[model samples]
Target: MARDEGGATDSPAAAYVFRVTVRIDPEVEGVWTEPDTFETTVVRAADSPGDPGWLYFRDNLWRGECGDEAHMRAVAEDALGMPVDAIDFRELRTTQAYLDDLRAAMADDLVEFNAETVDAALSKYLGSSIHVTDDI
Candidate 1:
């Protein structure tokens, strides 16, 4: 959502931002010893799940979300331009309508996801990282 100079929030955006925070061990010499973190916000249109542009989300989501920790960390590191030591899939900021539409689309394509239901498909891919909100 956009906010005017009056400090009031506006309507939600048409796309969603997947914000992921990562902790990195700084390589700088003698400047710091503790780890630092940065968040990367990846924006994607609130399009139908069938759209080709949504492939990146499907491609990066592992069946077992935490099975490949290194792979997940790499994704965050690539986006943040730093070697990430840890990752936290913050949230998917979106509107209620977009989320409902996505779930409906997923429900219709359960076969493609190899799951009996839409929720199962979502869990297989995103785990518990999804958080729908109008504050996008």
Candidate 2:
């Protein structure tokens, strides 16, 4: 039932689109000449009803060509500036899955608004993985 920063009572979730780039560490020389990168989107409940605010990211996730757990950990640790063990990664939900979750999470809100309208708003970003952070 929360509202977005735009003061729209219908839009209760805030969404973010990120371009994630994973690359091999330059120090490790290998046949792999390119870095792996992907785009991801995350959405979270607005801080307060009618509070319009969102965060942005600059750097991308980078890794080395080794393709080992240690190497992957190094890339995440370096890019995130946090211990590898501390980071938690979760699989994103599909559009249908997200909609189902949203419906469950916002059951009360749905009673106040039309479910179809909410689905339409969220449908535009289908197929993108979502990461729900604690900040939400």
Q: Choose the strongest candidate by lDDT.
A: 1
For model 1, how does the per-residue alpha-carbon lDDT over 1-136 read when each residue is reduced to its tens digit? 4679998865543343445665666568766644366666655454445666554445566442434567866865776677766554444456677678778878877887788988888778767666677665
Q: Per-residue lDDT tens digits of candidate 2, residues 16-134?
A: 33223344344566644443333333322323222332111101111211224465456555755444432222322224443355545444464433345544323322323344443
The CA lDDT of each predicted structure is 0.61, 0.36
Q: Which clashing pairs does model 1 show?
A: 1-136
Residue 27 lDDT in candidate 2: 52
- Per-candidate TM-scores read 0.59, 0.25
* Candidate 1, residue 1: how far the Cα is off, in Å: 12
List ranges where model 1 is wrong by over 4 Å.
1-48, 55-57, 62-67
